[model samples]
Target chain A: MAGAIAGALAVFFVLSVYLLPQSYLGSIHPTRPGPIVTDVKLSQTQVVLGESFSLQVSATNSGEHADMQILSIAFPSLSSTDGIVDVQKHDFRQTPLFIKKDRAIGAGYTAQRLVPAQYPSIEASNRPWNSGETFSIELSIKPQTEGEFVIFVKAVGLPHNGDQAHWPSNGTIDHQDEFVSVYSVNVTKA
Target chain B: MNYQRGSLARMQESRRLVIGYTLVSAGILLAASGGTWDVTNHLLNKPETFFAPPHAVLYTGVASALAGMALVVSASRAAGQFDWSAKFLIAGVALLLSAGPVDFVWHSTFGLDGLLSPPHSVLVSGMVTSSIAAIIGLVRASKVLPAALIVVAILPVWISAAGAVHMFSLPFSNTAYFNFNPHPIAGAIVATLGFPLITAAISHTSSELTGRKFGILSATAAIFLFINTFTSIIPNEALVSTIPFYIATVIPFVVADAILARWRSPKSLYMAGAIVGITFFMLYYPLITHTYNKVMDNKTVWGSLTAIIYFELMGPLYPVLLAPAAAMGILGAMIGQGMVRRAILAGLR
Candidate 1:
């Protein structure tokens, strides 16, 4: 009997440590593949130090059904990691915190709040990408130095987030034309 | 065939042990396989429900291990048997089973860490303990075939103990998978997490199997784990590249067992632990670096003293890892010694 109690306590303590809520699970959406197109255009390919530039990105969901989410993340030209550049995109400060009781969201979401992130993992918009719909986003940046750098984009389709908690995603295949995109570009220093 | 003083009853008991041992052994393997495949499945499949297919297989394995261990114990207990060794084995596997629901809740609450995050570590620990249980159970039985199965049951855990993602798993060619060399990631994990934990486990579990048997067990354990880790990660991503084995990976076991033959104290166990954990990375860091350099065609990458100490090689290997390994070695050795002593007492009575 004593052993049983000890065992239960041990188990409970362990579960408490592991199962404790770390973050909110992001919503799971059914996404389509093609013609799920992605395009990123730079206002200037070459810029002098301290010159301001813009990146215009347009993503279209050309599918039969309504596309739930077409997400993209920005990689570089941030103030935190480097001081040579200043950039701005989504206003995460103004974005309301996604607060829901545990288990409110359906399966496939993780503990960490991913989509509504500070810098890298910010979504284009909270609004879903509809059928024959397109979402466009622009970022303005001013260089502080002369070194060239590639800005990276990790675009996640609805089913793009794989089943396992933090593994590489094999698209869930929720939609017939479901697609996952990874895009990047190197801007030159003038 | 007499009903009283029944030879049949004795035969039945003997049969139960053999059958139960087989079932439990098979079950543990299934569980290990399920866990490994689950990693890839999680990597490839959509964000999983706790009740995913791989998880289900793991649960099945846990259930089977529990039932099998129970059967073997009941058989032994019936014969005026039952030892602490067997009891410990049962408790270990039971913990492994109990971790399932906790793991489910963990996934639901915390989402995914993919590393031996939290409850997952508990699950792996349960596996380690249960594998230890199997070892103790077989040694108590003092049978050759069942003992051999103990070696198989304990295979695949070295990777778990090494705990850093894909330490012995994942290919060295992965250095060129991108611009950055990933061998540092592997080296970092082993040096920081795996060697000490694995060394401790090896020392603790190897209590009963001494002298030449200890040598055989470690050799077989390392080899089988190598095979299992290789096959689990090979066909999919070739993550199971055979780089570590080329670097005299078996030397630790050979060296440790030799020390144990003479000085069978906790001190020796500590040294043995350090030898295995320290040597693994000492040899591994250089060999893997050379391999990565060959692949990347760049000599200066991940070769910095900073990288060697912290990210790439020898930094986390020494006092950080070795000290703990030696400590756990002593602890494991003592616990193993105690368990062996208790099993002997029970068997004698």
Candidate 2:
């Protein structure tokens, strides 16, 4: 009886060890995408002081599914004392861009357009967008008495899905930024 | 006059037991409470789920400590010659095993992504060390006590295996069941079951050779061997492999207890426990590091020590500690046996 018991136990032990290598016992499912911003570009690398430079910023549906009201882009510098110029100098503070898809852009599929950056009216408050699409806006640079001026281009947004947005609008998301240089062009009586 | 003298001696013995129990219990409680907190912080991505307000981890900790103290006091009171050291050792093992399930349930309920992410190395060490201690204690204790302890040890294994199987078959299975996954609770149960059986088997065999009973020793030795075998078969990367190993360890201990009926010859039994305990400790030392830093690996330390110890003691390598965690098992058993021998000698004098 003792031998039989020991033998049975030994068999079980061996069997358990054998089964230890079996995979797929504890697996976790993947999570949905949070948020995304896309197609952020500067029109020109070097521009004459007081000349207009375009920044084409857009929001897109880069996630697995289209999310609603994903605050894709915001231009906080438009309201600053130095306005867009201060933002260009120190890089735009990445703030959370609010997206409200209820105000559908154009065809309700893609939202693409250019705004004059020189005017304060072209601000994030005026633009509400959704993801799975794109939009562009132009900015005008005016260097006060420029030796060399740098302007920043930034885009931020989240997926339309209800998942928390990965990119925050209030700060530089992972410090990604686009810089535009403004050189003062002298127009002497030549 | 003789009765008065005997009562005085018993009083002194009881006082000593109480001191031993208090010290050991305090140390274990401190370690478990501190270690669990550290483990929760390091292992859990969202520790708030378990450590946050309503749950009150501190209350649970206090309760566990009180339970441990109560068990120790009860054991000492019930058995006039109850080895307090052994009780502490068993309690430590119980704590180690319980920690695993607590962590598992916490993770499962919280929707944590990785089921076995960021393994708690300290918790693992505690479980391993506690198990060795428990086996050593069982081997050195009286026949009835060891038998009772074995039954207690078996319960966790059955529950853990069932839980693991259920978790594995869940509709939404997580990645926790993978091989090399650190499931503290399951590991605890496996250690509890395996160490006792191995120690008992070794004790029994040694008793037969010396004309005595040593069931605990045989059980401890068997568990060490089983752990070593399990380690050899499953690499650290294979997290899921532990489930079967756990099942394997539990079944043998239960079977051995049923067959052996009683362990005789406390000294020989303790010797077996010590050998298995120390061997397991040495074997697992290399794998005990918190970080998987290859530069400072020390698995061979125990293996070499085992070879030397066995050669010097038994005129052969014995190959017991050559198994995974065998060094720890042997070391703990030795420590336990040493304590038991002292107690026995004191009782005799």
Candidate 3:
């Protein structure tokens, strides 16, 4: 009897170990993969100091579902680690939108955006892109002073399910560093 | 021999019951307190800054102890009455099993906003179910089913522990898919909560084995081996990645076993203590300084220090520690048998 009990226990132990990796029974939704950044470009390779130039960034929907309300754009500051390019300052110029609101782009779709030249800093942001949607953003820059300079553009996507109303979640929550770098520009005296 | 029935007999019986209740209560309380403290400390440091007050700990400690004692008392009285309540036992088990998913949903949806969240539902449930089952078995003086329940509770833990070990050697190229990107507190709670229940269950069932003496030794040795396996993998410096393994498996099992053996009527507390004491001094004490140096000088490996220590102490090449740990376990069992024999003799005298 004791031997039978021990043997039974041994078998149960073996079986239990085998079953540990099985996913919990009732997970609500399949985990969706996040968006991917593909390519980025600036309107001009080099710009004159105090003159405005545009930055164009492209992203593709690398994930399965159409992500609505995913914030993908970042605005550059002079204080940013990436050196600033001078452009005319406009207070109310809306930044380019990376993801369309209330729109579900089918899998494998691409989207693009062009920020008007009136906006002062390079805009950096990211949003959820459907599997094939290639999206881009263009930022207008004005260089205050120029030596050889590089401007950095960063785009991040917040998950649709994430709590955006909360303080820290409203900003780039994941800190996914999908970045683009522009070539060195020399502002020559006009 | 009409079993004497009177106030004197009842008083003696009640005294025995009180002592038994006290021992079990103390054991469960200490285990719960240590487990919760270790888990919460890790939790507060994580990105989730949820804090359970010290008073909460006291409440849970006292509550669990009282609950455990009540079950034991009921079981004892039921045994005396020859009326075993399987419904009560089943209800307790059901309660334990329900806790895991309930808490998972509550936490994942509500986050730390769900304060006073019970310890991981699975662990609490497993512990309570197993404890209740043990009490039932003691009442009926039927050993087999309680042993079976214990074995059932231990299965997932061992499997998870082994899987966690396998994760280290997995090539980093697979990190994209395999990496959980887990929050630190979630990882810590999983580890700290699971392992103690596994160890305690094993300790409880050791008594039911055919060669009770040998069974105790084997269980103790197995626990040590599991701990060695854990310490080998846990990175020295704390990282959220390693927290899952340390909290879920290592701390709970080692700490619980240490406390349970110390305070309970363990078959061989002294022997268990000696092995644990030596293992700590030789393996962990020296490794602490090594870990500190690694953390201060090389931050990258600091989180990996637990794994490094585990490999150093128990990897294939080092038989010295493993050999003694196993030997001491066997010797402890023999000593335990002698102690039981002596007690029986003293009673006869």
Candidate 4:
């Protein structure tokens, strides 16, 4: 029995190493891969009360086969790292503490709250990100108060018609998304 | 009549020893599988708790190992003598059994901890100790088991030793409360030295046990690749591009084993060891990328997608690392060959 089991395992190992990559499982969504943030440059890390600063995020469709259309780009309300920080405790929608409002949003972008309790964000769906092509979104914001606040900029999109059966629509930004950039913004009194 | 009785007693003792060692080996395999799966689940950001399935599998394996050790002790008592190998097995089991309460106390006091915290370190230490015991026991009992079984027994030892290396090398031990991550340069040095050493030593030991066997080392590598790749790589969709790279990595192992099998000399063994040693990073793949985080200046978030990109980022720098890794592997192979030689001279083979 032991010898038979060992032989079976050996066969399975061989088959998996050689065949799995060639099989359909290997190319589940080969044509349409996900979007990735290549570079994120914050105009400034400090902002005075009633003063404005901008954050520019550059993203691209890493998968070379097809174009990927973005749904929303927002400063995610949730922290991706495992921690005790309660994001919902400070609901920016009800009463803005750090960011008062967007002074000027980027082209083809609308300023709104993706989630009810999420921070102020921008959304655009008309543009399709081409292979190796980079697109930038800059959000100029006005601060309302003083203190340090962490701002996480994230992008969520689909591959034009990406394998929706496998890649479901991510309606809103949450901690589950991986494409994000974290920034620490220190706001001082004017 | 007295001669007949003595012969029967000897047969019973051999049976008992074989059974005991087999159970211990099976237990080690189970524990190693559970540990690997648990690490994968953590990387995938799956919900984790003390009662998770992987933890259960791990504890069950630990229990089986303890039971097997107990049986070996009982058998040794009847035979009226205990071998040195049995002592190591007992010590390993004791350490494994003691790690639970240590972990519990650590969690209760510290609230939460990272991978290389004191309790986790103790647990990994137990894995290494028990893995060593299993390997030694299988070698001593080689007379009863087949060469294939003995060769397969090398997996647990290789994995446990790798785990021990990870304790110091990976930078995942930092939490909000404690910072157990090693210094970046220190981590890089340890990873570079440790992985090659483990690959060479384990591969050499497998070869030695099978008497310059051609496929023994290859078989061991194959099984390890299956386990690690299945758990860590196959699950994540983004890492699919790396599958071919992993399969390609095994070619060096095959080549190294063929060299050892074809030529029977110290120089040839050293050459084979060096060949296997350079494959350290490739064998480890995605998980091993974390070891080079500080050295490579990688600042991306550590998720599945980024892990793939981070791993690819190491390609340009790997050429610079291969030579030193090969040297360390040669040293490890020498030490491993010596251990096997001593065991054979002591009449275990």
Per-residue lDDT tens digits of candidate 3, residues A36-115? Answer: 44665566766676676665555544554332213233333233313443323322123343332223322111122222
Model 3 stretches astray by more than 4 angstroms:
A1-74, A78-190, B1-91, B97-105, B108-211, B219-269, B277-306, B309-349
Model 4 is docked with a DockQ of 0.05
Q: List the residue pairs that clash in candidate 4.
A: none
lDDT of each: 0.47, 0.36, 0.36, 0.66
Better of 2 and 4 by TM-score: 4
Where does candidate 1 chain B have its weakest 10-residue lDDT segment?
B301-310
Candidate 1's displacement at residue B6, Å, is 4.2
- lDDT per residue for candidate 1 within B1-349, as digits (tens), equals 3775576777777677666655665676667667766755443332356687677877787888888888988898887666665677677677777777887786677554443344666677776667656655555454344445545545534434433334243232221112223454454444445444555454445535443244544565466445444433342221222233322345455555566555656676665555544444332332234333333333322111112222232222234555654554455555545655665555455
Model 4 Cα shift for residue A35 (angstroms): 12
Top-lDDT structure, candidate number: 4
Candidate 2: where are CA atoms >4 Å away? A23-190, B1-34, B37-41, B48-248, B252-335
Superposed on all Cα atoms, model 1 deviates from the true structure by an RMSD in Å of: 17.6
Residues B228-327, candidate 3: write the lDDT tens digits: 4333323222222333332222322233244333344553444343333223222222123222322223222222233333333232222333344434
Best by DockQ: 2
Q: Name the top TM-score candidate.
A: 4
Task: Give me the displacement of residue A46 in model 2, in angstroms.
Answer: 15
Candidate 4 structure quality by residue, lDDT tens digits, B246-267: 7666767777777788877888
> Model 1, stretches more than 4 Å misplaced?
A1-190, B1-8, B36-57, B73-94, B105-129, B142-147, B153-211, B231-247, B258-273, B280-311, B315-338
Question: Which is the winner by lDDT between candidate 2 and candidate 3?
Answer: 3
